[model samples]
Target: MFFFQGLTMGLAYVAPIGMQNLFVIHSALSHSLRRAIMTAFIVIFFDISLSLSCFYGIGTLLDHVTWLQAVILGVGTLLVLYIAYGMIRDIPAPISLKDQPASLRQTMSKACIVTWMNPQAILDGTMLLGAFRVTLPAAESTPFLTGVLLASGLWFLSLTGFVAAFRHAMTPRILRAINVLCGTVLMLYGLHLGYTFVQFFQI
Candidate 1:
């Protein structure tokens, strides 16, 4: 039950695809598989820590901050829009690897930097995902965390393998498709975020 529950929720969280998956695929196909895994581990580390932190800390504190919901919604807006822009801008860079060798340490460091420091990940991991756990029974709370961590691991591993297997398929045209998909999702998410913000402020 935990496995399937984790699998379903994990896919829901990651199904749309995102920047982290993009980089992992890019690295695995062109650079070192070791490097992709290295980076993925870092992402998972931060993701787990953040999930736990939000579950324990932010979820509780948020109730007291009357204005926090609005503030968070606004930040989420900028985040999604900015990611949309980045998806458009960086799509071209995926193929031009500079032939740089993937360094395990470098990949790990980069993933950690992005996941831990990025406001978007923090918001999603804690404010959003963690908040979902607040209403669950105590026995099932463990499953929720399990689901999150399992999702992260599965996403990274599959992403790495997919890219490695289909490196040749990811041509420029395919990248264009990926860019369109990523950009569209980011924009839609941005719109949802804005709507959420407006709902909170009622203006």
Candidate 2:
């Protein structure tokens, strides 16, 4: 039960405009296959660790410091704003890599930076998921995290693989449509986050 719930929740949380999905999709089409798989693994590593931290560390912190929720909310809100700017400015699409992925050390370095720098992902994977996991009976949390890890890995890997199969179909028109949709959702979600922040802060 915990595993199933975790799998469903993880899929719901991860399928959106987060960095992991973007990297996988981009790499599958444009970067080396091995590099793309490595990126997905890096993302999964972060997700699992973040969830564990939330499970153990954040749960304890929040029990005492009610303001922790606000901090997470603020971080999430800010990320949405930053991404909104990028979308609204119609920033030129990233240049797709024509070269093979970097060596293992270089890939690891880049993956670390990308995984760590994404504030929204950090909050969702560690902070929110952690709190929820802590609420579960201790017997189930391990399986819960296992389910989440599997979901995260599968989502990214399958996303990249499926998109790669259609590499030629990712025309400019398609990319533009995706950008428009992503930008719209980012702005809407940011506004929602701001509203939630205000509502929770006042309580």
Candidate 3:
């Protein structure tokens, strides 16, 4: 039951085509298969780290801190809007393998930033995992967390695999359409978050 619960929750959190998913998809389509896999792994690492931090105690602390939440929401709203703007402006061209691609260090840094800076991801960890962790004993937490880790690893691997498989068949027009869709979604979500942030001040 714990395994399945963790798996379901993990899928629920990751199913959205948010910034992390889009970044992973872009990496898979435009880079070497190995590079794409590395990026996915880096994201998974961040997910695990953040989830564990929340499960341990940080989530509870965050819940009590209204100012911190406001700050996070404000910063997240801005960052997401910036990302949305970038996505809309930078149209995808026909992807080509470059002789000199991004270094592993650079790719890893980007993966870390996307995963960590994502406001939605942070909230999900603090609220969801934090709540769930309270329902289990310490011994059970490990197994539940293991299940979560498995789900994260599996999901990213499958995502990268699917994107890599179909990348060659995808035309530039299709890629551009996808970019537009992702940007629109991010913009809408950012607006929604901004509204939610405003609600925090209601007396």
Model 2: per-residue Cα lDDT over 1-203, one tens digit each: 99998888878877876555654554565455566777767767876666666556655565587777687667667766666555555533433545455466755654544455444565556566867765889899888877777887888788877876676557655665666666666667677778888888688
Better of 1 and 2 by lDDT: 2
The lDDT per prediction is 0.64, 0.65, 0.77
Alpha carbon lDDT of residue 34, candidate 3? Answer: 78
- Candidate 1, overall lDDT? 0.64
Best by lDDT: 3
What tens digits encode model 3's per-residue C-alpha lDDT throughout 1-203?
A: 78887888888877777778877887787677878888889888887887787767775666788688788778777777777776667667676665224687877766665666666677777788888888888778877877887888888889999998888788888888877787788788778778878887773
Return the TM-score for each candidate structure: 0.64, 0.64, 0.85
After superposition, the stretches of candidate 2 with alpha carbons farther than 4 Å from their true spots are 1-35, 88-144
Deviation (Å) of 24 in candidate 2: 4.8
Clashing pairs in 3: none
Sort the predicted structures by TM-score, highest score first: 3, 2, 1
For model 2, name the residue pairs that clash: none
